[model samples]
Target: MKALKHLNKYFFQYKWYLILGTLFTFISNLFGVVPAQIVRYALDLVKETISLYFLYDGFGAQTVVYEIFAFSILLYGSLILIMALLKGIFLFFVRQTLIVMSRHIEYDLKNEIYHHYQTLPLSFYRKNNTGDLMARISEDVGKVRMYVGPSLMYGLNLISVFILVVGYMLSVNAKLTWYVLLPVPFLSGSIYFVNTIIIRKSEEIQANLSKISTFVQEAFSGIRVLKAFVQEEPSTVAFTKQSNIYREKSLDLVKVDSLFTPLVSILAGLSSVLVVYIGGQEVMAGRLTPGSITEFIMYVYMLTWPMIALGWTTSQIQRAAASQQRINEFLNIKTDIVSTKDISQPIEGAIDINHVRFVYPDSGIEALHDFSMHVKAGESVAILGTTGSGKSTVANLLCRMYDTTEGQIKVDGFELKEWNVQSLRGQIGYVPQDVFLFSDSIKNNVRFGSLDMSDEQVIQATKDADLYNNIMDFPEQFDTVLGERGVTLSGGQKQRLSIARAIAKSPKILILDDCLSAVDTKTEHQILNNLQEIMKGRTSVVISHRVSSAKLADKIIMLDGGHVIEQGTHEELMAKEGAYKELFEKQLQTEETNS
Candidate 1:
């Protein structure tokens, strides 16, 4: 009931269409039963007219009987033709209204789910799988549509037809009506029992399908790695195992349906046999006429569909309910990262991290401990650290990707929580270590950080990142569509493109986190020189392991574990003969050895 309530807005929004469709369904079913009553009347007329002709035994009596029979036949034929035409017309409109309404609602729900996904925090994405989410939006939403459209339409039609047919049957013979409806209770019980199994099986099937989707999505995303490591066969085996589980779950659902459908048909068949046997005996006993028995049988036949439809509609509702629950779970997630609704103030480049502590949710390990730093407006600071030393964690905290567990992070005297999240992120340019480029043209990828950036700005950023010549050498140049994740470009080229994207944003604060690792030393040095002039007035945090990258910063901080071990200017840190100096000497020796 709660799941159904979630869909009420959509239902009410299109109530007019639903009401019209239901009205047409009622009219169509009404016309459908009229033909059966007409047949009964025609039969009774023929029997009475023949009896009168036998009694009179004259030419006049015979002529009257012939005229009555001819009129009755014409009336029945006309009623059949008119009723069939009306039923067809109304049924078409019923489908058009109800089915189309379901499609519209489906479209709305899909968009709503997608919009909800966009609002969710990065933590929510880490906890959920892309494949599972995709299955909910696609397959689960489809199941819900089945309940809204065809299932609702057929269920309503069954109830309307059942009521009219049963009322007419009772009118003809009350005793026979009781006997004909004996199997209904059993059928209802069977539907209730089977629906439980169907619901359980449906959930399992949906879960397994999500597994298959997850496996396929991961496999395709890492196809390059699989081929490079010669692990394609192993990946195929894993996918096959997941596929088999999906197939087995689907077959379990099919087995339940197979058993339930036949049981429903058998019960309907029993009702028909009971009506025929009992009504035939009543006819012979002179208590009921042949026409009444014929009408009773026709009503029993009409009841067959509603009984069969009971089982089908129950299954559809159960499956839809299971799917709705999954979708509701996703929609109900509370995003941990949200900004003050009323605040839209822009941030300045000044950053202050005061006694901050942070831990990753999944790992339960502290990424930063009592970490504190202050960057004056327009200052360039470099973070130098080894792997697992919290270099990237600092950058993430600064961007509010994950909020600090303790203390405060302020930008230009305002706390991080006080600023609108989108507004805060907009002012910062962040280039991650693992660069991700969309499968789009080079120009579009570079312009992604700031969609409204001009072409001249994009070209200048590319030149600054040392990627302009590489782009122009291509046939289509900026218009050339990149393969998935810019696979066509070299590692260095991809890294430079990521840098160009960030530069085009014209951000007040820029954080480049090991973004130049793929490029050679000479190329890295050239790019850094170009960026030096650009970073003059902007607050910049350059995070890297290489000493060359840190040496260019006005101030450098060296971290070990989750704590900062040293902080000073490049010359001051080198002169101290500490961790910074040791790293610098090692890199210089490696360069000399390579030369």
Candidate 2:
């Protein structure tokens, strides 16, 4: 209930829908009472007319009176039919107002969650799996819709129909009405006793479902790896084990859920028996007329659907409450990476990393230790390090993906955090180690960073990245649609396309973090040569392990285990007896050996 309280705003938003739906509910129930009243009146009329004919010994009045009675019955039967038809029409309008409003709320909730997902930091995604996130937005929200739509409609129907029909029953004969409603307290108690267990079971089912979804998502996403390792049989066994757990959880819930309908039906059956026995006694005692007894029976039957439906409505509400709690858990997580400053500032590309120390929040890994670097506007610096030496962390910092744990970083003499986050990221073009491409046309992929890029600009960016020739060989060229994650291209081609995407943005600062690892030295050298012209008058940081990629930089820094081991120009580093010189000689030997 605490979690479901989150939906109160939506209820207020669609207040008119609820109000109108309530109005229709009352009107429909009123029509139900009218038909029952008409039946009662017709039955009493027949009884009275037949009795009078018998008292007079059918003195030729019998034939004429019988004919009139039949005519009156037919006319009353038509009125009952008209009332039923009107009730159905009002019921349709009830669905239109309430159910349709639920859909609008669903649309709004989905958009709200998706927009929040976009604003969440990368760290948030790290702590949560994609499958769980997807489930909350899709499955969880769907359950909430059940509560707002069908559950709400049926609940109102139960309330309005019960009130109107029971009130009429009291008017006809209060004693019989009390006997018929004897089941109400027991029903209420049964629902109360079952509520706690239902909620607990629903929560377990939803959680187990999330785990199953995550397992399937991972299996499908990594199917290629499973086949490559020849572990398909093992994967299948693991999946079967997980599915068995889900099945058990579901069956436990179904065991409890299966009780609701039968329980409600049993109570309703008891009500019918009471109407037959007690109402007959009342009629014999002259407390209730035969017509009144018939009306009481008819009203009890009228209440049956709303009574039987009450259990289903209660179950859906419990499930929805459970699911809504899951959704709110994620929605309440506050992101720590939002911008503190609201002002935008121009970046001249001068950067200073003054004794910065940083650790990854999710894994608690110290990626950078006392790292310090200085780059003037238009200068190019290459960070040379082995894997896990924090070369890529520097790129992440410059892009403001994560702030430093200990020290301050500044761009153009302003603290990184002081500048608007969007403004800061927009000015930096970063090509990370893991290249990702959407399943879109080649031209659109290249134009991803800057959507307004002309075709000529897109072609030139690809050319600079040394991928224009490869794209031109394709049937559709720029318009060629890529498969999932750009599977249509080779590894090197994908890397080049990612590079093209970055450079197309024309940022004030450019950072390439080992993006050329897939390409051969020849292609790497060709692309770097083209980048030399592009890097002019803009701050550039090239992070790589290859000496060939660093030789042309204005400055070079070598790192080891999150610490800077050496720093100098390529010429100066080669002049010294240090790790940088040793690495350069070894790389040069490898090239020579390959040649």
lDDT of each: 0.88, 0.89
The runs of at least 3 residues in candidate 1 whose Cα sits more than 4 Å from the true structure, single-residue gaps closed, are: 52-64, 281-287
Model 1 C-alpha lDDT per residue in residues 1-595, reported as the tens digit of each score: 4676789999999999899989989999998999888888888887887888777786686887777778878978998999999999999999999999999999999999999998887677888899999999999999999999999999989989988888888888888989988988888787788888999998888888888888888889989898999999999899889888888888888888887668867877787788789988998888788788788778877877776777777788888999999999989987778775536665568989999888888668888888888999999899999999999998888888888889899898888887888888888999999899999999999999888889999999999999999999999999989999889899999999999999898899999999999999889999999999889889999999998998568899888888989999988987999999999999999989987
After superposition, the stretches of candidate 2 with alpha carbons farther than 4 Å from their true spots are: 55-60
Error of 1 at 117 (Å): 1.5
Q: For residue 213, what is the lDDT in candidate 2?
A: 82
User: Considering only N, C-alpha and C atoms within 3 Å, which residue pairs clash in candidate 1?
Assistant: none
The C-alpha RMSD in Å for every predicted model, in order, reads: 2.0, 1.7
State the lDDT of candidate 2 residue by residue for 1-595, as single tens digits: 7889999999999999999999998998898789888988999998898887677673787777778888999999999999999999998999999999999989988888899888788778889998899889999999999999999999999999888898888788888889899998998998888888989988888887788789888888777788899988988898899889879887887777778778878888898899989989988898877888788878888888887788788889999999999989988987776666755977788989999999999999999999999999889999999999999888888888888999889888888888888888888888989989999999999999888989899999999999999998999999999988888999999999999999998989999999889998899999989999999989999999998999658999999988988998988888887999898889999989987
Give the CA lDDT, 0 to 100, for residue 413 in model 2. Answer: 83
